[model samples]
Target: MCSHTCAPSTLLQRDSISKCSLCLCTWLNPRRWLNLQEYQSKKLMQDSGVAVQRFYVAHTASEALEAAKRLKAKEIVLKAQILAGGRGKGVFDSGLKGGVHLIKDPAVVGELAKKMLGFNLTTKQTPKEGVKVKTVMVAEALDISRETYFAILMDRACNGPVMVGSPQGGMDIEEVAASNPELIFKEVIDIFKGVQDDQALRMAANLGFKGPLQRQAADQIKRLYDLFLKVDATQVEVNPFGETPEGQVVCFDAKINFDDNAEFRQKSVFAMDDMSESDPTEMEAAKWDLKYIGMDGNIACFVNGAGLAMATCDIIDLHGGKPANFLDLGGGVKERQVYEAFKLLTADPKVEAILVNIFGGIVNCAIIANGITKACRELELKVPLVVRLEGTNVHEAKRILTESGLPITAAEDLDDAAKKAVAAIRK
Candidate 1:
């Protein structure tokens, strides 16, 4: 465990960390799992011996008022319990000034909570439509001596976990990363041994922690590493980690995002799943084991492999056409799935033309062609359909298309296929 030394005079004035170079900021994508709300992970941090303030989760205005009244502190921080940040600058759907506020009057908590609850809160990190604030976290306000960033995440380049710390925090980490990357210091952690003494001390030095504070900081780093490993979390972050006037560091704002693949073992994390968090269609695509991302355009893509799907979209754009969506049928897709993909493409009102680009290696071109033929016959395909088939029973696929006598246009290559798709959309 790390320790901090405080002089009587320094603690009196609440002297904070003065240096900025001791800080670093970075954000990690949990990716597979549903992103957890700040309130959700706050307990995890506190339970692991990381510093966290007392807080109450209120689902209703009355509950918020009651919770605020129960707080020992004269002033409390009311934060909208949303997955995305920028709450301080964000506006509520009810036209509230801020998603985060410092309230001294307990009576006002009800009013503020009323405006936030069931209202949409939009932030830069969220979708354009924003997410609804179903609840709020009301916590005691603190006198922060310093605000610094710290985190531990897997580093693909190093093939292991890396601990990052910075003296500069509280601002957008993205800006810090882009404009002043040198300020951030990272140390690689050993998976076999976990966080070593040297790594924690190095991170402590970077944070400019001294005496007991350095030891405490180092100890917290180790515990955080342990937490990440214990929960199989992809990231554990404490942005704007607060150093109290008493010379004690606390996780003022904490985030722990777990890996989705490990959910089978992480039952607690799995229990936090929120299905409404991501795109519904994308979730459906996941069921088919297909790679798909919806976009705004008229031409739809049906291609094998992600690289070719990207190229198909680019060429469509290059030829003055917009791709309606990105659909990549990975190696070994079922014939029924191809038909279903076609159905999905036609389901989009914006899709005026369907472009099929198949480079059959492990894929059977005949199945693809047959699937298209089946979809067209059964669904009575209204839009123009273009097929560009190559390799692995390519002639048989072409012969099947010929026999079907569907108005499906055949292209010789990718570029020619793109041109035809665009032209078909225009016509």
Candidate 2:
């Protein structure tokens, strides 16, 4: 079902796939994964021997000016370091036209940096409020002769890693994939053997590099793959992996995503995460080892499993209600965690009603019931609450809720729960 080419892996059975499959799925769907800023990604690339323009990171106007002067280039490029894409076309809250600018004079770099730093930059990939720019990358500008696309990604279709490249670059690769599919080329890599020399050469050739330039591009591609494996990366993409007018190949811009599963072993890489760019509520949820994503709706949902959590949101929408957040408690949740979950839900001003949908497999329904009662009393919950419990010890949980003398509405099923949650909001 993956969009990329299909290939079987020795590690996986024909009937079963690995988590990397879901990784690839989320990548195609454009979900928010653990990714680094451009400066961080390019730093990894440069350390791994991938040719890139010399750059310096600046946190202040004076630092920006110093960085530009340090680059000592005739023309310097100042890029506001935000996590979002489309930054070149993005506008800052200060009325600045672009997040990226090419400075002809190094002295004026401080002025532009003043307009960028501490300002919120809204791009197509960011929310309307936008993310604040705290840092900038001042780098030497290049005279590029040809631009090309290159990427290494975990592919479900390949059952492992895949190298993707294209002659078309510096634009939305998704549009190219949709329009001119032939321009997109793919090489399924042997995971054990790694990216073969021939595989690298073929990808470089496909990107339209010729003569000595092709060899340089191939070497860069190999180094990128080494970096990918070194960091346990799920995806590494270079847009406009370009050739200079002087016949030098360099990575113009890049984005890298690391596998969340590898955080245990890749601690150093994970530590580089910029939490300021993330939602405050989501970060709070992470402290409790909970999976939560904030949404734009008014109904907050707390479910035991990811699949059921999604279903709860869908059914809420089906009943003319919108979900404010997706909070998955997973299995074996503690009573305190449940209480904390309710605290989070009630804390959201947008949440007019709360929906608790739990299927007790490894979880005990009584723990959830006790947590709910404690949360309502301790937090003095103001929002209407709807509860739908099933699986283990369901009767004991229902009895506890009934004896609590709370204003909680008990539902017979998920459908009833969603309807009640929506009706509670309307009232």
Candidate 3:
């Protein structure tokens, strides 16, 4: 299906077949079908004849500034092209106001762009690479009567996808949910059954949606759901979905997250991946087929299973310490995997100490300890390694670690190991 050198006819046939298969799977998760990039979402909006901001894409900082200079509006948004949320929360604000830069002077745009692009934004969910300023979008800022949230997501409660609307929008939707839950309204849709016009009317009515603006919101919601089904989108959110002074309902900003499995049929969807926003270590881990993620703790943790790896991190937190990274050595892991995991952990500057917790259920502790010993020798790890070995070959594991003469503290239990790791980090 990837037509680098294939015949044109064969490529077209394969592409068509792939599209059909993906469309069939849209029902698999109607709400969470197509995961689109910001650029793609903008493109989709343009295709739908929505009134959106005029924008330009610049791959470099200079180009972004140039685009800003050309725009009629002095305001520009230099977005790092990664698909992550809370970009305006100052992951790399670079003194940009509300994620929108008032380009009063074009001279500062390039400097801001260069600094924000390729920076690191650590969110609670993931540490994303600041979207490289491949393209800066320069647009007119709008004055809004109100900001609201509009999203169509798979509703587990309804056993189908649903459109959720809130009069209260912006970055603080979570706060709104916590403080006032009644303000939010939801409408579930059975994609196969299709959405009824009356249902849209009622939803609009319940939300106190009135006047021309209300009708527009209702229509936009309907159209958004249609796009969701058509594109097989996973999550589509327009936060602070605006009611501008001109009676136009505009999605001032969009955040979309997609399912990778659907990439087979959604060729355009897959093209949305922006590598500029991904961490180098994570990218490298993906390349090596490893499940690894960086964290903000001082203790670099390496465990055998995903569940156990998480438990280890929790225990570390329970003991009043943070985990530097989550590195799962995996079940039935070998010396090579262990060695690579260790290398990845030490590579992180945030990691001040290392914790090797091996349950050795399906994986023998001795193998893990041997890997640790091997990894230490090869990498000459300067950080302290606090290891807890149990289950299979526990004694052998301890012997290997102790004999290595590396800066390793071996514990017989989780509690003791966690304490030691915390103590080591504090020291």
Candidate 4:
């Protein structure tokens, strides 16, 4: 039940050596990864003239029942509006039952919605505790005859855009691609020309489409391509792009992912999903253009660059210290950003100690030093923090920290920093 599908690009490093097998990706900025819900994806596709099943969203059981009654269909599918997959077969920790249900009678919609609403459902794709389903969607049942997988994404191997599709859909396409590699069809698009009509026809023919539907299917691909670039989408997926008995094609499911860096242009699509509803720390990091993801460890490791962050985490684990979080301050660091990162670390009770690993390229160590002093006095962080500074005014940075009269321990290198931070938490 894969929803958002995109292979992150591998990060390249200059003159770095470590035994730790850590994979880093600076291309797909972690802070910018935006995943739209199923209903939301459908709406975006519908706007592009793609046919989709009619549905209505309900935030309460009464609303759900009312929405179903309005549909007046003989059968309906009630889907939980959570940002996770495998909902149809997922189980809730509270034993609330299924995330998706099909009811023959409209009366059953209220009964099922009662059990699903306000319940946190743990799916194979969600967190261990699962996401809460505050709303549910009731859609009219469709007579889908054929299910096919269709997607356009950036191929890391090709280093360009590629459209992938297969007649096999509604199953793990990855597994299918692995077991039956020949079954999958790929069309590498020309950067200047975009996805050509011939390529779309090939994709349609590969998906078993024939007659006038082939032309319709090709037009669908063209429209999807236009939408993809227009919205700055990294990946556009329509799994089980269904073919009806009437020789018409409709998207049974849709998924669209946009690059966070280009979010300024795609504000409308992003505004569809509220930023306030996102994780507080993640949203806060976005405000400062920092990349952050929390973990369940005591040693909070802060560093510059994505590759360095991964390396820091590896070194911390090597030194028997688990990282509390991965926080990367992008190039050209400012004192305010440094203070903000430290302030965030202080707010986390799980953070027993802090490790500041800064590689000042365009980032001046002097500003970092000032930020540390300001953050220390303002937050009054009682926990031990190990600081490691390298490149661009390193000596000046050390002098500022040494004379600041703080209890912070200074490390010579990454290994030294990890050892000191681990020692602080152990005590």
Output the number of the lDDT-best candidate. Answer: 2
lDDT against the true structure, per candidate, is 0.79, 0.85, 0.67, 0.80
Reference-based TM-score of each model: 0.84, 0.90, 0.69, 0.87
Residues 1-427, model 3: lDDT tens digits: 2212211111121101221121221111111123345766877766665546677766677887787788756455556554555555545535443333555666677787776554544333344433433454555566777777777766554666767767777755656555666766777788687667777766666555678766777777777667666666655677767777778888787655455566788777677665654567766765545677666778988876666776787799999999888676666677887888888899889988888888878888888888889999999989888888888888888888888888788887888888999999898
- lDDT tens digits, residue span 333-415, model 2: 88888888887888888999999999999999999999999999999999999999999999999999999999999999999
Candidate 1 lDDT by residue in tens digits, 320-405: 99999867788886888888888777888988999999999999999998889999999899999999999999999999999998
TM-score, prediction 1: 0.84
Whole-model alpha-carbon lDDT for candidate 4: 0.80
- Compare the candidates by TM-score and give the number of the best one: 2
lDDT score for residue 34 of model 1: 55
> In order, what is each prediction's RMSD in angstroms?
8.5, 4.9, 11.1, 4.8
TM-score, candidate 4, is: 0.87
Estimate the lDDT of model 3: 0.67
Query: Residues 201-266, candidate 4, lDDT per residue (tens digit)?
Result: 999999988999888888888888887888888788888887888788888888787777787888
Instruction: Show where candidate 4 strays beyond 4 Å.
Output: 1-28, 91-95, 127-129, 156-159
Those runs of model 2 whose alpha carbons end farther than 4 Å from true positions after fitting are 1-32, 93-95, 127-129
